[model samples]
Target chain A: MFDNIDKTDINELGEFGLIKHLTQTVELTQESSNKGIGDDAAVLDFSGYKTLISTDLLLENIHFDLRYVPLKHLGYKAVQVNLSDIYAMNGIASQITFSIGLSSKFPLEAIEEIYEGALIACKKYGVDLIGGDTSASAQGLVISVTSIGYAKEEKIAYRSGAQEGDLLCVSGDLGGAYVGLQLLEREKQIYLENPNIQPDLEGKDYIVERQLKPEARKDVIDLLAHLDITPTSMIDVSDGLASEILHICNASNVGCKLYEEKIPLDPMTYETAREFGLDPTVCALSGGEDYELLFTIPQADYDKVKGQLDISVIGYITEPAAGKEMISKSGHVHEIKAQGWNAFKNKS
Target chain B: MFDNIDKTDINELGEFGLIKHLTQTVELTQESSNKGIGDDAAVLDFSGYKTLISTDLLLENIHFDLRYVPLKHLGYKAVQVNLSDIYAMNGIASQITFSIGLSSKFPLEAIEEIYEGALIACKKYGVDLIGGDTSASAQGLVISVTSIGYAKEEKIAYRSGAQEGDLLCVSGDLGGAYVGLQLLEREKQIYLENPNIQPDLEGKDYIVERQLKPEARKDVIDLLAHLDITPTSMIDVSDGLASEILHICNASNVGCKLYEEKIPLDPMTYETAREFGLDPTVCALSGGEDYELLFTIPQADYDKVKGQLDISVIGYITEPAAGKEMISKSGHVHEIKAQGWNAFKNKS
Candidate 1:
């Protein structure tokens, strides 16, 4: 029997408040645990290696819509999403455990299809599927994946490592995933309006793929090794480029300056944004689920990756006193504010 | 884009089939993963210590009914359930990551209450709550917890270690949790049928506690260490005593003869079963969620624990040809069959 606590609404505390309250009471006893909370992953000092642990939860309806999203892609993306956190730490994922809560309404075949997707991702990333549990759910499906990775103590990256003058870089293009989502939702609406009509998804392949099957940037980590360039700080862009930049700035106690003209946006993303009557630059800055690698490298290491096709030098870290600012194409400076995906704010 | 496979129903392969299929494709590349899948936990050779990893998933409606279960108890029980797996391996849990899929209907306060339960369990068990994800769900709530633990290589226990002639021992009393569940379900039905009626639950305290808050027997692991005895094989009684015994026998390649008279059931469980017109012995053998440790120990070390108050030596391991049998009080021998909880079983 538990003593009843003060009946306070969870919405008042918010997601961040709930996390802080839960973690505030946890005391770490293991000396091997170098860092316990408040990072991409928990850092553990194992023998000869530093291990990183991270987990992510995806729920049906809220995280994915099975009506348009394939089960296989859902599974693959679940594993990839967790692996991204480990990648954010500049660590190579070694093992993963996947736990699924299945609704009784789901058929056995649907569960296997999900696993088939997860299997493909695990094989692609060279990680082992170690252990997991399966249980029936009362409602929609839930997938939670925990990935364990390891790196040399010195090679490990953290969000708080950025220093003033470090060049900020991001891998691949941005805004595609967010725009892809818009395309899918639009198609869903059209189909709902007329049952006899088949939805068209012509020529929006890149953005569509970005939304449905986002890849973790493990390649960037491998490339850094080959170029002998270790990032001063790193984080995966899951919550939009703007929000991620703000996180690094806040964590590292510094400010940043971004060049609007330098931000990477695929031509398809720009074209689609125009079609939807939205600004392409705004989508690139505030769109979420890009799954790109955002990192800060020393100025001396910039030339090593300057000519790389997938890399973009979007900004530079600045002293805290300078504040975070984005330079517009017209040469005006504007403060950057995070308007990333917040399910709470969006929910009716 | 994924090549379309005729969607198979999950019921076609069953839970075991799905697990086997998912694990079949896993390829372990890390040398540190000494063993992966097909065990209580994955074994990892992390430097000088051996690490074990296990995960469990709990879904609302299927796993618990909010009508009778409180949020804090749900949170505490979630962690306790995962820790039981580590205790099954005779290891000390060091870290845990909890991922929750929250439905839109849940207030933020409800989520916090769940975390309060988790934090209480973590502190009680001396394990750190390291990392986790909080995501919105379209349907009911889901909680997935992964526990990481450590043990000396030589001290590690596995389900495949039992030898012929070893003694099968179980900790604490059994069948109470199952009976407790029946009482709660009955109360729920009564309350649902008539909201104005105040149900009676005066003498069912033990059974109700057993059902609502099952304890992981980490103390048994400590007791074994104090007595200088290590189990040849072990597993937690989650899927009932009969099911766990079969697991030990199958994994160890041995048979067992359990004496029904030797099986320990709490007095409350016996009385409740009679009141419900159910056989007490059947409940003891097939009822689940006991969270008691079931283990096999060599004859040489039997005397070390013979005087233990809470342990019951219910059976003895034999050659595989002997088959699994239970000797009834009337001297009649019957082959033991696993009739544990099967989520896929047809229900009226």
Candidate 2:
């Protein structure tokens, strides 16, 4: 986090001036990026490569609470989530257009902090900040990011490409981001009653970071390529494991049999969910915001991903007649239901 | 505008269901579009072409007033504004990603109407609605659109390519949208005082439509292509004529002399500004949202565009030492200034 010692008024720089100032340090490193800012549109050359495009809209109060979220982390997470979509298709993100609308309450320094974080993620992920728009909002902050990437036609993965008997796999642990949110909300309430409490977040750094800075599984995509394995179907785990499984099943016209015990859960997430009197398995199945990549590989190619420390083989595709089901740890079978993140349900 | 007779609850469909229902009519018409919705990211094949990317953020109450602006028009205008950026680069927009965040007050019918308008624009513009995100907002409606297009390497125009002797030209008329906005505001004020007043918008249909629904100058781009004229520099007139001239001048490291009489203005726009006790010339100079193509071509290409009904030669690029100036109808020279749309100016 950066200090706001110099409180500069946003109006002084105006809209165009602020955009130029924020993107002054942006340098395009991608060969596909022929143009960056300072044009009607950014120019890119993706010859001989299939382009991948994804967009995400994040509104304040609905998608995030600024009280518990730092501006820098918010910016970083915004880019990561969109990049996760590209990785879900087994593509490499090369550029992004980040548009933001915020009210007058935010000072120039605050806006700069957000841009600093966004640029950091772009640099770390090897993507260029091509073009974007900035405007004053009527209320809270608003962010929309469009990520563009590329992949070979043969290497691209689609949700409907999965076939029966493919092995279901997921990268990294699940339920961490969801449990991390629960911890943050708890701390927020406690601090609201007495602000001097300093938020008792000791030894809770892992879950807290998971909630604040969830990373896209780019390393996993690289590993898959290195291992010469292409997922039959792939998607990013953004709306919980159960929801993602249903999406792949419905698209591929297949059902799945998932083992409850095989669902990977970090120790911190398990203990944290337990402390909140919530079922860990339910948290992993229903809780969301986990930016891990979920994919499937044919059984014939299972040997390539076997014993991969970062991967968990939790299920297998079945005929549509079998229906989506999960075998619980107690040897009981239950139909898998999706309680994915519903922004409209509660708001409406 | 479509009627919202049936009030369908948005929660019934949820986020995923709503997105699926809204985009069900979308069909990929572009050969570059290999895949669209129902995936993590849209797959596009812009092989052998330089891709152009642009984005815009529109906020309700800040960018538009829902009281007077219909949902359908709002949706159509949002896509049109973003497409204008691609046209400004002398490229054909092939696809767009439209993302929206709206409050629960908007019923399912209202959202459908917006999508209906968006799809109409996409079909008419020969662009595909590739992918986007729909979310619930905590406040008013928020729209973000990203347009993707392609052009050959040699055909792409940049703002910095203008030369000192280039002729500055603009397509279509200016100040119509701004004056149109003034007329709408007057009517809105009258309606607020007495709801019975049906808004005296009888002969004002021309200007009214200019504000509510401004089309991007795609025809002018096609015309230029037909005439085999490659502009040295180009930009869209979204931020007023004077502001855009300054941008071209600053980027090209040159100066310009814009003639007051050469500025194009519709008869309705001129009369409306005069009735409001505002200078018609000033309105054309500083009032933004024109969505016309502003470009500079070499002196040798003047005959190619001469006698063109829609195209107007407004000025001529000059040496940097000449300074940016505007010649009044009375033969007086004055420094050109930009009072372009500034969202941060009055708010902060």
Provide backbone clash counts, one per model.
Answer: 9, 0
Model 1 residue A164 CA deviation (Å) reads 1.2
Query: Candidate 2 chain A, which ten residues in sequence have the lowest lDDT sum?
Result: A1-10
TM-score of chain B of each: 0.86, 0.98
lDDT of 1 by residue, A207-234 (tens): 9999999999999999999999889989
- Which structure among the candidates has the greatest DockQ? 2
- Which digits, one per residue and each the tens of the lDDT, describe model 2 over residues A1-348? 224457788989999999999999999999999999999999999999999999999999988998889999999999999999999999999999999999887888989988988999999999999999999999889999999999999999999888999999999999999999999998899988988888878998988998999999999999999999999999999999999999999999999999999999999999989999999999999998999999999999888888799999999999999999999999899999999889998586
Of the true interface contacts, the fraction found in model 1 is 0.37
Per-model TM-score on C-alpha atoms: 0.86, 0.98
Model 2 agreement with the true structure over B1-348: per-residue lDDT tens digits? 235468888989999989989998899999999999889999999888999999999998889998799889999999999999999999999999999899888889999878888888899999999999999999889999999999998998899999988999999999999999999999999999998999888899888888999999899999999999989999999889999999999999999999999999999999999999989988888888989999999999999999899999999999999999999999999999999888999576
Worst 10 residues of 1 chain A by lDDT: A1-10
Question: What DockQ would candidate 2 receive versus the native complex?
Answer: 0.90
Candidate 1 regions off by >4 Å?
Answer: A1-47, B1-47, B346-348
Candidate No. with top TM-score? 2
Q: CA shift at A288, candidate 2, in angstroms?
A: 0.9
User: Model 1 TM-score?
Assistant: 0.86
RMSD of each: 12.8, 1.4
Native-referenced Cα lDDT, model 1: 0.78
